[model samples]
Target: MTQPNLPLLKWAALFEGSSLLALIFIAMPLKYMAAISTVVKIIGPIHGFLFLSFVAIILFYLLTRKLPATTTLIGLVSAFIPFGSFVFKAKYLQ
Candidate 1:
């Protein structure tokens, strides 16, 4: 059986993934290299919020939709690694 498509999760995953990239690539570089900490101060909390939202959405789907545990594990792992969410969406969320 095919799983239901979750657009919210897809968007959340995208946002979370981009935020992580922004934090690591843009924010960190500016903060450390240019001695400008303001960018991190702005991006860090945004990334954190996006990450939490992504995890919460994953948990909600796992419980309510009865998704496989491995999917949940993959979703959670995706939140940590930059761009992992995009891969997860392409592979699983389709």
Candidate 2:
């Protein structure tokens, strides 16, 4: 597979980060505080899909771009942390 272009990476990162934020700041709160399961049910799958897509791109670039092991590791790890993908994009992907 080819390395994803910077624009593609940026777009994916933006979407993945946004989904993570919504899942955490919107869905989680609604699920916990308001006893609302619907938002979580909706946002959770969306975030999961976005996150997986972001990670797949990361891995693809890791091979095609020959990224350092640390950078690859960071990309994967960031997917699990809220706002991490945004920070990663700014700090490393740029």
Candidate 3:
């Protein structure tokens, strides 16, 4: 069987982490403080997509046994924490 693409997973982690940061730090503030609901409308779905994609890729790695349980667990759990994905990537992927 072929191996999973670690580089792609790393990139997914980055994109997912950045999107979360943007949503929380930028979009949410703009929505609440500036009454610009459109920012949340735009960023929410993008973040959701990236989050799902990142989780899916991590699950793929887990199922294929490409990564250990602890690493995969970190990858999955990190999705909920701000900048967690970046930390996971730096710790594991690098």
In model 2, pairs of residues that clash are none
Q: So what's the TM-score on candidate 2?
A: 0.80
- TM-scores of the models, in the order given: 0.89, 0.80, 0.88
Overall lDDT per candidate, in order of appearance:
0.88, 0.84, 0.88
Q: lDDT tens digits, residues 5-56, model 2?
A: 4676778889999988898899999999999999999999998899899998
RMSD of each: 1.7, 3.8, 3.5
* lDDT, candidate 1, 59-85, per-residue tens: 999999656778989988977777899
Order of models, best lDDT first: 3, 1, 2
Q: Candidate 3, residues 1-94: lDDT per residue as tens digits?
A: 2234499789999999999889999999999999999999999999999999999999998898888788888889998788999988888887
